[model samples]
Target: MTFFLPFSTVARLRFGSASRIHIFALYRWNY
Candidate 1:
């Protein structure tokens, strides 16, 4: 999910602090 999205776009969405953490975790997992 997060792997398919660009970090800039994710940041712009501002899903929330918790979502940000989840997305960041996904990003780390993806890499």
Candidate 2:
């Protein structure tokens, strides 16, 4: 059997710590 979910990303995005913010900032800068 296989299972998948999408909300994990949102949860991580909202609840994620400084690392996510740093990465996201880097991503935004790269764009």
Candidate 3:
């Protein structure tokens, strides 16, 4: 479980940045 926790956190960090960029672009386009 501990190993899974680290992997999940890393995945979240990587994907989270991309997801934030996508969301930001969508928001900017709406404006």
Candidate 4:
């Protein structure tokens, strides 16, 4: 479990950033 924990966290962070960027772009067009 210890070995897989860090990898999961990093993957979550990367995915979160990508999603955040997409959301930002989507919101930009709302104006």
**Best model number under TM-score:** 4
Choose 2 or 3, whichever is better by TM-score: 3
**Candidate 1 residue-wise lDDT, 1-31, digit = tens:** 6766787677667767768899999999999
Please identify model 2 stretches exceeding 4 Å from their true place.
1-16
Query: Looking at candidate 1, what is the lDDT of residue 7?
Result: 77
- Give the poorly placed runs of model 3, Cα more than 4 Å off: 1-9
- For model 1, the stretches where C-alpha displacement exceeds 4 angstroms are 1-15
TM-score of each candidate?
Answer: 0.49, 0.47, 0.56, 0.64
Q: How far is candidate 4 from the true structure (C-alpha RMSD, Å)?
A: 1.4
Candidates ranked by TM-score, best first?
4, 3, 1, 2
Clashes of 2: 0
* Model 1, CA-based lDDT: 0.81
lDDT tens per residue, model 2, 1-31: 1233457666676777767888999999999
How many clashing residue pairs, candidate 1? 0
Question: Which residue pairs in candidate 4 have backbone atoms (N, alpha carbon, C) closer than 3 angstroms, thus clashing?
Answer: none
lDDT of 3 at 17: 100
CA lDDT of each candidate? 0.81, 0.73, 0.98, 0.96
- What's the true lDDT of residue 6 in model 2? 55
In candidate 1, which residue pairs clash? none
For candidate 3, give the lDDT.
0.98
Better of 1 and 4 by lDDT: 4
- How badly does each model clash, as a count of residue pairs? 0, 0, 0, 0
